[model samples]
Target chain A: MNIDAFAFDFQELNKEIKSSGQEELNIDNCMGQRYIGCGLSRGSLRIRGVPGNALGAYLNGADITVHGNAQDSVGDTMNEGKISIHGSCGDTPGYAMRGGKIFIRGNAGYRAGIHMKSYRDKCPVMVIGGSAGSFLGEYQAGGRIIVLGLGSDQPCPVGYFCGTGMHGGKIFLRCGQLPASLPDQVNAKLADDVDLQEIEEDIRQFCAEFDLDRETILDHPFHVLTPNTKNPYRQLYVHC
Target chain B: MQIDYFYPEYEVVRNKEKCTRCGLCVSQCSNHVHSYSEEHRRMITDDAKCVNCHRCVCVCPVGALKITGSNHQFKHNANWSRRTIMEIYSQAETGGVLLSSMGNPKDMPVYWDKILINASQVTNPSIDPLREPMETKVFLGSKPASIERDENGRIRNNLPPHIALDVPILFSAMSYGSISLNAHASLVHAAVDLGTCYNSGEGGLHDDFYRYSANTIIQVASGRFGVHKEYLEAGAAIEIKMGQGAKPGIGGHLPGNKIVGEISKTRMIPEGSDAISPAPHHDIYSIEDLRQLVYSLKEATGYKKPIIVKVAAVHNIASIASGIARSGADIIALDGFRGGTGAAPTRIRDNVGIPIELALASVDERLRQEGIRGNVSLIAGGSIRNSADVVKALALGADAVYIATGALVALGCHLCRGCHSGTCNWGIATQDPALVSRLDPEEGRRRLVNLVSAWTHEIKEMMGGMGINSIEALTGNRLMLRGVGLNAKELEVLGIMHAGE
Candidate 1:
């Protein structure tokens, strides 16, 4: 449906869009109204202004694009969908997501992708163009998290203890140097051709959306982090 | 030679005449006070073994057992008395951690006891419970915002989903793992019979008890264990357990050892792995976040179920209740400090949170002031002891009362405060196969039903005496209650008047 700039409750507008028999929905003056295109299975939501927290929470199979920065907890606990943010997003961009793709063009706040999990044939992916905050992917159970440091001078775009309590999943960082004080549970190493192959599709999709060269992004040294299986910590207490 | 130390309170006495050769108590005692001698003709009783629960005394079939208070000389001073000495000794033994159960066992004034119930005297006539139709039935759910009518002026879907209780009492959340399967079955069956609801605690619903969904309030805590499509659909309502009163600000930990076969399966955790429910739902950072979860569950359940947010009665409970009322929750369950637990850090259980009476009154008053009392129904629980406490809770503005410890007491809980050990002699709190088998569901359920029915009769009697015929009339009727020894702050928080003038 073709629409013009109007101050509408994003929730109501999104509801209208889902119920309407239209392929494209253009929401204008959408100032901080939440759950836009949330749980929508088949549709395209195009927004002009800033969206609120949980922009596409539990999104099943729709596609959402935000013209401006999105709030915290974007695509939170979602099962499937694709969210492309033209501007930077806030913290916990893909929290507890089981399946989906979240592509952000700017920096993410603390603990992004925290508790993100995955299952067989459904590994969620998150790509950030700028730096991420401390404790990134804290307690991440599963899923792939990639941070591409494009125009930043920081040695590492991610912060200290990047993958604390990370039991499963892989984290790819497009930086030469790894953080010094990584947790003992996680093993960090230079990404080889095999590591690059896993996140190749996600990087290509991110490059295609934001007009970045995938080969140049892959040329930089990458660090892949996975949980160390040998040094497993167990039995922290006595029963009696 | 080392002398085995007893509590200095109990004296173990045995009858020499009816002494049996069987030394079952000797092997049963965990204190190691009993020993068998091949040469001895009869079993010997050592005085240093008992914690005064009288388990051995009650077990002996031939009536050969007796226990009494030892005549250990403490200078007769009321201030420095036996209880004081015991407290000190307990602290010394457990290194200053005082663990207790079944409400505050200390000398602190019990407000429920001090508060007196008023009845109609000469001016207003009293109705006898036997003759009059005194309404003890309570329905817990969201009442309609306003009645709606059809074209013919007939009622059209005016009623909200509610649990109709024969009395304003319910079995509170004591999980299957914390107690036993038989105990859970007993509670479920009793709740069905008694026309009340039984909470499924944080433990997931047992497969066998799926038929009792109408009487079950399934819980979802931080762990979200066994919480899926079926678990949500298999309940009358969903309770989001935010904080437990017994151990406020602390999460639940069903130790790996207790997680056996079915318990492990229901909790959806590996056997021998501690089911650690973190103190908070990581996603629930604010009231708005709580609303998301509440609505999500409602959506998942097709909005057929009312959502209950159970929170611990902390110091600032009134303010918190205000926020919860606006969080789209249909019911607010307030658990006080005196509530029971399978296991909690001793410090948190006894030393934290406020009394339920004050919390209930404050929350009701706060919601009323905010003009949102109609938004949510309040169910108060912590240590609702008897019919008197139930009536008092209603008068204090609770729509209903949740009873866990009281129900367990009916089903053979001794309140030994040793639930952490999981060797519950009464078979009410243990997960051991043998101990759990001891409690037959048939008999246990009957006991619970009897307890609730008896309490219902007492509640009706109390209501009839006050000339209040209905539970709805009794709710927030503070005039029916008067404080005897409560201070100004207590009386203010309780929203009741002092005894005289």
Candidate 2:
């Protein structure tokens, strides 16, 4: 089913999509409509034009593809879904996401993948093809965040304070050197073959999704970042 | 190599004449304050190890043990009290933030004690609660501004989703990670029995507790732990924890060591990973951003459940509450500075937010003046100690009251304020297997039920005394309350008159 969402507000468009009982939907001319597939468990939605903040928040198991740029909080706290953005996205693209995958073909704004955690058998993944803004993966408890930086010349792809307060998870950055502003709480090392194997399938998937050559994307030396200490606050307090 | 400047604050006294060498005290204390001395043929006590939990004293087979404050005191200096001197010494030694558990124990004014309730005389007939049908049931949510009728002239069913409470008392938020599963079960069972609700604070709900979802209010905080589609849909209501009163403006850091096994699974994080809840929601930069979250949750739930926004009772709370009300929240829960916590920095817990009484009064007045009081129901919490405090909160404009410390007290908490150590002898705040097993869920549930039931009965009696047949009638009825020994400025902020006037 194709929906011309030019004249419809977010609530009306969402209501029509939910109540239509269709398994597949194509939302055209979508102009900054927030929460496009909010909490939708099933079905596939293809959105054209710009979508607003929190596009697929709490999405259970649906598939959402945004043709144009998406706003902040693209997949806020989303679980069990796949969101693909063709263009650049705003801040906090995958904030606190527990599961599912978010593939951004273009650069992402600040705080992408912040607090993204993983439970048993459910690991969330986010792949940023271009540079990411500051505080990337801040306080990230689990999951994988890969920044390819497909066409950048900087020392690192992520901005300052990357992985600050990070306690879990690994951030794979395709860079020659780690960010200078990286906090002491996180440790960075050159990616080994064993370390690269963990994210090989995810990188291959990202390459296929964005129609890029896998060999070219994997040509550069990568730096994998992991939290040095799981208990960052163990020594910060004394019992009164 | 270290000189201990601070002495033990408490002394453990054991009576030799009455004592039998049963070794009950040795096993009862989790702090290892008592041990058998084989050489001396008696039990030895470590006063420094004692947290004053009273577990050993209560469980001793013979009446032989008592704990008392040590007579050791600092020099006669008014400013440098004993606690102050010891605290400085301790900080100098460890160089760590002083962390405390439970509510503030500072000498602060509790307005509930200074407020007096009204009774009817010959002017108005006081009804007997036992003989009359006193209505205590309250529906919490937004009420319609005007009545609507269908085409057939019948009243339209335009009421939105709301929660019904048999009494105006609710068990406040205490997460599974910060407390034992048995403690959570007790609150859940008691809430179901009382037709009220218990909140699942920040921590994700355990699978075993899903059966009591009808009486649960699941919370979503900064960390968004264990918060997923299923968890969001499993509760009667959703609460967005903006701030905790005990440590307002600061986020909670449940150390990684405590996040093990069930807690790790429940919170959906790796075992031994720090569960850090950031102070502010990165997505919520303004009221507009808050609205987005509220509506997003609403859309996710299909608008079936109410959304509660819980914030600490801080300065400018009235304005903050107004913003929340306009943000499409169905309820606003205000937790005051004196609210309980599993652990908080001693400085922050002692001197952070305002008292619940004053916060409630100002917020209620602000909402009413703006004609938006019906937009959201107010739940006042902090130090609601007794039935009288509940009554006083209602009179000051709280739709209901949330009780946490009081409920834990009912479940055998000795108020030792040692929850941060993760060695609660009462089993209310620890995740240790043995300590958790100490609290039987059935007994805890019964005690909670008894406490709420007794409080409900007393609330009805107070309403009857005020010539009010229903609790709703007593809400925001400041005439039912009078200030006693409160200064003029204090009464003005409380929005109450003097006792004589």
lDDT of 1 by residue, A1-240 (tens): 655436566545655665677877887776887666665666788888888777776677788898889987788766688999989988777876767899998888877887676655677899999989888876566689999988878999988779886656789999999976799879999999999999999999999999989889988999999877421333332211
Cα lDDT of all candidates, in order? 0.79, 0.92
Tens digits of per-residue lDDT for model 1 on B228-345?
Answer: 5577779988999999888889777676578789987786544654555657766688999888777666555656788999999999999999999999899999999888887765
Candidate 2: pairs in clash: none
Identify the runs in model 1 with alpha carbons over 4 angstroms from their true place: A1-108, A112-132, A135-153, A157-240, B1-17, B23-57, B65-105, B144-161
* Stretches of model 2 off by over 4 angstroms after superposition: none
lDDT of 2 by residue, B1-501 (tens): 555555788999999898997998887788999999899888899899999999988988788999999988777898888877777878888999999999999999999999999999998889899999999998888887789999999999888789889999999999998999999989999999999999999999999888888899999999999898889999989999998889999999998889999999999888888899999998898999998999899888888999999999999999999999899999999999999999999999998999999999999999999999999999999989999999999999999999999999999999999998898988888998998999999999999999999999999999999899888998899989999999999899899999999
lDDT of 2 at B368: 95
- In angstroms, the error of model 1 at B322 is 1.7
Give residue B121's lDDT in candidate 1 (0 to 100). 88
Model 2 chain B: ten consecutive residues of lowest lDDT: B1-10
Question: Residue A198 deviation, candidate 1, in Å?
Answer: 9.6
- Candidate 2 achieves a global lDDT of 0.92
Residue pairs with clashing backbones, model 1: none
Candidate with the greatest lDDT versus the true structure? 2
